[model samples]
Target: MAGGLTRYRHLSRSSSHRQALLRNLVTSLVKHEAIHTTWPKAKEAQRLAEKLITLAKRNNETARRKAQGILYTPNLLMSKLFGELRERYAERPGGYTRVLRTEPKDTYSQAPSALLEFVDSPKDVRFVMTAAAVARDLAEGREHTEITQKNVGKVTRYRAGGKGAFEDMVEKVRALDL
Candidate 1:
């Protein structure tokens, strides 16, 4: 009889039910940066979080309200999601989320699930190293303490001896005039 009720009711009628739903989604998203969940729930979370991230990126009053309305999250969580998430994904375009299939778990409900992950593009390490090197050169007026072959972590000396015949051949090569 509820004509416009387009909500996906997961069969619970209490506020606790709804809160638990949101908490589980957020926790899983944070813990693994992804989760294997039902299609409907996964889609809903992806849409909601992406909208929140977009709003956070704008960083204004209207956007703030939009984010607050999207997820029933607290002020602290909302702050982290908005501030830190905005900075983390600043240079990226859309399609920032990914959902993938994984092994099935034997749960009460027989529905299969998929893992959803945030697809952060790889940063250029070479460019980062070059920037760091430039900064060190500027501050110190020289290369920052050139690491000799010894001070760097564990060093493995490469020797040309293995078995008995290999050692004999190496001695013969060492004694060669040519």
Candidate 2:
């Protein structure tokens, strides 16, 4: 009866256990923007993270409620999703997250490892300044350094402060010609 439907990877978990695992993974991914795990687990989590981001892109109350249902903790994550995350990926068609295979810590283990992260996340936090910082710099007419480094594979730019900081920084930098 369930024929033709794609059976998702079980990751050797029961229905409830798997649901709980995915929920926690989604929450962690949203809050931290990145997580490291074994290949199979990362792949499964990536699937769910992308879906939640897509839902967030809608940015309506219904979409917010739907995402809240899937996420484990709703307040901060839901706000981030509906606000900054929604704006960041608005132009992108899909594929809001990425899975990068990584070297395993233990060479003896056979399981592959991977890093799952949102596409917009930054690699280094120190390299970025918050919107408030940018605003302060502009208001004070301070010299601001440009982002000279290029993003390597799986190494995206980091956002300082919290919500909307990265976007705000970019806008200020552009406006100030800095």
Candidate 3:
């Protein structure tokens, strides 16, 4: 019996498979800044991603070489890790990534889903512009328009075509009494 030998989840995978899985996940997370996967996988991947980010924060030759070895394809990912991501997380201490629970893609699968992403990632920027605002800016001959986070809800509403349409459809269905 391997008593008191607690370690990590085996994930029902062989050693090589598990390593490859984590390598791919970490690479994707570093490249895309976010990735969605099953909760267990995301949780496991988070460990590796955080470790890599911590290494990136060091911004030293040894750290860069270590990250390069862990990643599958080194060139692009290593550059990103040593360049943008290193600068992005330089101020912070740790906890580089966050795991957010998301709705499952299929109803039949009970496995929980999650989104693993870097905190304060560029993709998470709240600033959103409505179609109308973009059109107005273009028509005004404005070469550069500043997008601030003030009107996020307005952008969402506009993109969703407003709540009135749904309410009107609900009222029409109620009139049918079916």
lDDT (CA) for every model shown?
Answer: 0.53, 0.73, 0.71
Q: What local lDDT does model 2 show for residue 78?
A: 80
Q: By TM-score, how accurate is candidate 1?
A: 0.50
| TM-score to true structure, per model | 0.50, 0.66, 0.66
Model 2 residue pairs with clashes: 122-156, 122-157, 122-158, 123-156
Q: Is candidate 2 or candidate 3 better by lDDT?
A: 2
lDDT of 1 by residue, 53-136 (tens): 677788888987866665544564667666666766676665556565545554677666665655441232222233344344
Candidate 3: lDDT over CA atoms? 0.71
Error of 1 at 130 (Å): 24
| C-alpha positional error of residue 103 in candidate 1 after TM-score superposition, expressed in Å | 2.1
Which residue pairs clash in candidate 3?
none
Q: Compared with the true structure, what per-residue lDDT tens digits does model 2 show for residues 1-178? A: 6666756998888999999998998899888888888888888988889889889887788988889899988977888988888887787788778787888946788679887877766642322434445555566787654532232112233323434545555575657754
For candidate 2, the 10 contiguous residues with the lowest summed lDDT are: 148-157
Clash pairs for candidate 1: none
Model 2 segments more than 4 A misplaced = 1-6, 106-108, 124-178
Local accuracy of candidate 3 as per-residue lDDT tens digits, 1-178: 6666847777889999999998999999988998988888898999999999899888888998999988988987888988888887776677778887889956898679988887656554221123334334445666434552234343333223334533343345444543
